[model samples]
Target: MKILLLTLGLGLVCGLQGLDNSAKGSPKLDGKWFTVALASNVTSKIEEGGSLRIFVYNIRVYDGFLTADFFKRENGKCIPFSVTAITKEDGSNLVHYDGLNDFSLESFDDEYSIFMLYNIKDGEVTIWGELFGRTPDLPDEIKKKFEEICERFGIGKDQIRDLYNDDRCEKLR
Candidate 1:
């Protein structure tokens, strides 16, 4: 009798878990979130062996790491994922916040960058810029790695799509 009762309780627990998993509302990928290039990248037309090539040293460094972030939706949905994109102080991180999809990121303290982009969607905004100083919490190795990736991916002429949309397995708002 006790064994049967235990089995019944276990079944109920499993059912409840399943219900919880399926319970969801209008999940919006809206607003900003943190993301990384899925290994695919494009290059800017002007940067094809030009004077502005070396990002760490010379050249006006037009592009840097993109650290996306966000503000809450007008509907009061909490900002999705916000991770600092760690970039050089020479520019700002620009990103386009979308109602259906976006990225959230911030690099570090006393950090700044440059960006230029436009928004083509309703209830959405695009931001892109040259980034500056990164957070002290970040390590040089990680920052260097990010720089390498940025050099490969952040070129304006490069129109490569993400290798994996769920690359970071990020949580969307």
Candidate 2:
């Protein structure tokens, strides 16, 4: 009887350990994503400091949001973002908002671009869209560079989209 009870206790402990691990490493639905543009490019042409930029899409689940900001990097320092507003929305929702540090990738020639990433929590999913833009359109070469960044981040649009549900749509206009 004692041995049986010990075995049951150990089994329960092991089962719970497995459950805990899976819970913490919960994969985000937006785990893999892509960046379509940069923010500075969109803001430069606008005289208004309130220039809007940056849009992320969850080509997988078809939902996400972007809050704009101006990002600046100093010598030997991490890029700093200045969030300008508090835009809020429901999950999988897409809305245009301003208030973030500008990510200026001058190499791209587009008036707009995107950073796509998703947040997965408790098996629930939400997409995040980081939008960037410029006065000029993004050159093909620069566009490729942006794609490279997405690939490096494990957010390649092709690979993830292939695995995600096919019903998703591109929300950015």
Per residue, candidate 2 scores C-alpha lDDT tens digits across 1-39 of 445323322322111111121244543322223333432
Candidate 1 at 118: error in angstroms?
Answer: 13
Clashes of each: 44, 34
**Which candidate tops TM-score?**
2
Off by over 4 Å in 1: 1-96, 99-136, 155-173
Q: CA shift at 32, candidate 2, in angstroms?
A: 27
TM-scores of the candidates are 0.20, 0.26
Once superposed on the true structure, which residue ranges of model 2 sit more than 4 Å away at CA?
Answer: 1-131, 157-173
Best by lDDT: 2
Q: What local lDDT score does residue 149 receive in model 1, on the 0 to 100 scale?
A: 37
lDDT of 2 at 164: 20
lDDT tens readout by residue for model 1, 10-61: 3221111111212255222222223222111213311223111112111121
